[model samples]
Target: MSTAKPSQFGVAGLGVMGVNLALNIADHGFSVAGWEFSPKRLAAVQAEKPYERLKTTGSLEEFVGMLERPRRILLMVTAGDPVDQMMDRLAPLLSPGDVLIDGGNSWFQDTQRREKAYREKGLRFIGMGVSGGEEGARHGPSLMPGGPAEAYEHIRPVVEAIAAKTDQGACVTHVGPGGAGHFVKMVHNGIEYADMQLLAETYDVLRRGLGLSPDALVNTLAEWNEGISGSFLLETTLQVLRKKDPETGKPLVDLVLDKAGQKGTGKWTVQVSLDLGVPVPSIASALDARNLSAMKDERVAASAKLPAPQAALTDEEKQHLAAWTHDALYAARVVTYAQGMRLIQAASKEYQWNVSLAELARIWRGGCIIRAKLLTPLREAFTQQPDLPNLVVSEAFAPVLTRMAPAWRRVVGTATRLGIPVPVFSSSLAYLDSYRSAELPQNLTQAQRDAFGAHTYQRRDRPEAGFVHSDWS
Candidate 1:
């Protein structure tokens, strides 16, 4: 009875994500011992008798003891203080070479601090980003792990065994040293926010402007999903639009509240982008859209007072509206992804992480929420030019954007005329316009700044002159 070998891996939380991940590890032929602080959760997991090789225990000491030497423990608890507290508890129990992975949405700085602290103590700490909700956790998820190279080697077998597989490879990579994994994940979520907002705007514009029923909308989106527009989120949108209320027989999404929720990652992305001087206006606009959506009562009250546009689409405009919207959606999405990737690039440069955008696109091809057909070309673009200044000018996407820009303008114009708020669409379009223009009105802004604050301005006409003050007064 006592001759059995110790579990090969350890999971120190039995939450939904933890249990599913433990089961996934066991499914990959690794014995995993799980521990949970909550007795109810522990009892619930134990009651299920999930996996024969996955053992659940309430005792923390026993859980730590069950793992083989140089233990590989994944802490899938809440982000922030809980992760630190868990680290404190596990530090005393772990050996010098034992690995502790914090698989939560923690801030990158915190991860850096923790990794530095743990390295000093001779323990390996990995800040891993796990994407693809519960189902992906049980089946396969995109795993972004950043830490010491040696520590990555320690857990590579287990991670690769359980990660989503595509033709490129497993959906897991040792992102970089320090907090690059979490940083990339944060940007991933920021892209997700922009992508979702674009979808929402598409849905709203089509539903309100074209007056299409849910069934018609589903058909339209389903056709889009078959082409280059295919993505996990769009597929999920199709599913949501197809469902009917069990009790009322009404379209389920129609009955749900208009408010949206977030878990701070999008805000963090925008915040970090500001620090890095990267413009992520698409993401920022998406975050603003969510915040505005939360003021349901204010919007409802304002609806009664504020006057909406009375302009109507012509017959030709109505006929071309859907096609225009499809192009607009795709174009805006490209811009959104461009913004997110640029932010990641800036962060990588600042942090000296050297994260490979090609590898990220490769891994995101499957399992992750933002998985899309576009990632193939995106990967190719990065592979061709690792230091590409912007995705908009890439050989793969420039012609496409040029071809689609007219339709995008039409969609934006139609939405504006109809008084529909396509925040992500308009902002992404503005970002594109600003990037392409050689001359902007910002010279006036610089002059105003100098006039007000004595800020020196660089003159374009003076070939050799440096920054100078004007006598415009």
Candidate 2:
């Protein structure tokens, strides 16, 4: 109730992400006024004193009052119903030209629908995808914002200031109109799932097949992080491996349950891929691997009935296989990212969002879960050829595939021989082979379809001619 007007930006919701992001804004010299529906969470925020500059209010009305005219408000609540509920409450209180930004993991379709609804009422709605977890929120994160172009100016400073920066620039962009931000974020999470699965498979092979202890595994992964396979996820895996259990005096990872949990972004990615007619075999396989892992009881029972794995590698052979496994992991990751980028490209065309593939790679190069050295080359590849068909065939990556093909094959073969389940690894290799093949066995499939369902088949001799239906005797 000072005579002064309020801050430049307001944040609604006081969850961990919400508070940290508010603090991040405050850290950059922007006064942040925040509102939380949960009194317990608001009290905790007050107790923690996360940032000195954040102003808090007890009600949404007062929070709305605590911002400047044409206010920029960031909504960090849970996605779905809660978001709609909050908007319904807040929209009535705001004047025209006031901007509300959703920084949640909302479905892109919801964003598209909401943007239109809000626009008709003279309110600007931005569906922004904020990546990087708690740590990134406190420091910096990659931000993808899509909305009406005019509304972006009001929030651009806050977005850029709180975003991670590399030598290239800040890890944030006005992606495109209508739900483009969320769509790209969804694809980002999909690639993350596949990348993590590949990492888990690599760890399993090195530990089980090569007899590497957790200590040895940590060193190996740490070493790999210094090479072409280096990444934030790989670096984090090394840290996880190094942690010891307090209760049992063993590695903490071994003590934890093997089941992985996801919040559905990966599933959405594969589903959307099907809708768009894009092949995302690596991503699909990764999602299936997680589902397969979740069937722990059935897997445990089946393990007893199945044949045991055989590990027959000598120390010399283990050394060679470890190197090959590294290359194999690199190859899989390349394919996974390539498939994800392709999905984004297809969506851009279908949605008319015109998102820049090069900018996406540049922003993802920092403050994201999937940040890696690989993105450097990826950014360059897209920059050189804006419409490059696939990343695997890019000049920067094709040589890598050529050089690693033999080793990648050996890793898959070694895993197969040892009975290690490598769904993603094998699937990625299969995708690569299928992509490069000029001829496939689908002709027989067409012939069979024609016989059973009268589906027409195109002859190779007259490929451009219309489809011809033939009766099978």
Clashing pairs in 1: none
Question: Could you tell me the TM-score of candidate 1?
Answer: 0.99
**Candidate 1: misplaced stretches above 4 Å?**
1-3
Candidate 2, residues 120-239: lDDT per residue as tens digits?
999999999999999988899999999898988789999999999999999999899999999999999999999999999999999988889999998888888999999999988988
Error of 1 at 110 (Å): 0.5
10 residues in a row with least lDDT, candidate 1 = 463-472
Structural similarity to truth (TM-score) of each candidate: 0.99, 0.98
lDDT per residue for candidate 1 within 411-437, as digits (tens), equals 999999999999999999999999999
Worst 10 residues of 2 by lDDT: 308-317
Provide the overall lDDT of each model, using Cα atoms, as 2-decimal numbers: 0.94, 0.92
